[model samples]
Target: MIRKDRAVVWGRFVRTRSGLRHHHPMTRKIEEAQPTWFRLSEESWNEIREAYRNGATAKELAVRWKVSPSSIYRHAWEGGWSKKRSADADARAHAEAIAEEERADQTRPDPEAGLFGPPGADDEAMLGDPAALAEQAMAASVRAMRARLFVEAEKLARLSEAYGRMAEKRGGPAVTIETIDLETLYDIVMNKDGRVGERFRVDPDDPGPRDPILVRYWSHRYAEREAFKEQIRRVRANARKAACRAVGLDPDAPLPGF
Candidate 1:
């Protein structure tokens, strides 16, 4: 059996641990019995308003004020305290909206600009300006033409290489030198409906004809090209994931690519 004094001490200790005190029950009873209207000093109310305006959360303000977060919210609501309007916020939203509109506009080709210009208007525009403007326009046109020619030349070079390889494999007649209709030939070669063979009337025994071997070679080449494209796509995806991981983001989480 425990001593009476020790038992009382132990009970008091337990009550204290459980957050009960001598005045707790009486205070609760008194509060329940009485009508209450809480009031605060003007300074205290100003401090609360300032805390809310400065972005201190209600819960944080409650901790500082020794009150519940809900009480802080109720007081703020009742006292008409609210977040202050920020000029920066308005500016940022406006800028974002403008940027979005610009991005959308970029996808649509304007008839007055670049490759989408009216059919015969571009040449006249290039020639119609003051000396400097005309010179600049001519320079731009020349640059564009040069770029197009370079691309065509590069494509012809690749086709010539392919033809050379084919000729070497066949061990037939040497490749004769002539200007090739490269764009037309490229379209024909890439066509799926056997249109190239039909257009050229390529008989099995005809000389300098594109044969099944050439078609099979190009088919394999296309497959390899697709595989390369897939590889590039995978590489870009992995790079994005790695970047996200570096910034403490979940790599597997869905994200807007744009």
Candidate 2:
């Protein structure tokens, strides 16, 4: 119900009559059915940038976007994108933006236990969880012990191999402690005749008596090897105890030996 004094142009209700039906100057523009071109979305902005990178002219983009080139130029300038620019500049700017984004990511506050880490994440947080702490402690202790044992075992293997080879060469199945003295024992195991005494010959033409220092050297080597084996035994025992205690097991309790 429009009053006779009011006229409706488009949605505006002006004075109406039966003879005056279509008389709007702006109606022709609407009648042409122009597509929407205002308030570009972020996706549209990216598309504009992509088009510019692909060397598309502003006129082409304007035609595709249903806007004037002037609008395209204004939006591109404000968005920090350029037209008629070299690909090198585009790539350089892209890399810089990526680096900037990476920097921002590093600065972003990433709280532990947020999604990836275990719950109760904080300094020494594992100490509060007995099970977690025990597991970690046991794992660390076992790793250390295993590494030590690996090195020691390799040394022992080399020593045993050398002793076996030397024993075989000396026509003895094994080194025995049945010799009369330490010097005789060393000589028997070292492939030297024990009966070869000091001044066995009278003349310099004959081979001089076996060097007295050889017995001393072999005796010291034997003592050092025995001591090293004892030390290895004590270290292994302590390592087992420490590992056991770490996992809340009794250190004195019998464990499956490695």
Put down candidate 1 lDDT per residue, 113-201, tens digits, no spaces: 44223446466664433443334444444444555655544444444455555545556444332454677657755974788756544
Best by lDDT: 2
lDDT per residue (tens digit) for residues 1-258 in model 2: 333338543543323456334434233242332334467787986887788767887776755665567777887788767545657877898899999999999999753213223445453775444444434434444444465645544444444444445446556544456646798767856657535443232344657454455657667877999999999999999998999889999999775784
List pairs with backbone clashes in candidate 1. Answer: none
Global lDDT of model 1? 0.59
User: Clash totals for all models, in order?
Assistant: 0, 8
Q: Which consecutive 10 residues in model 2 have the weakest lDDT in total?
A: 25-34
Q: lDDT scores for all predictions?
A: 0.59, 0.60
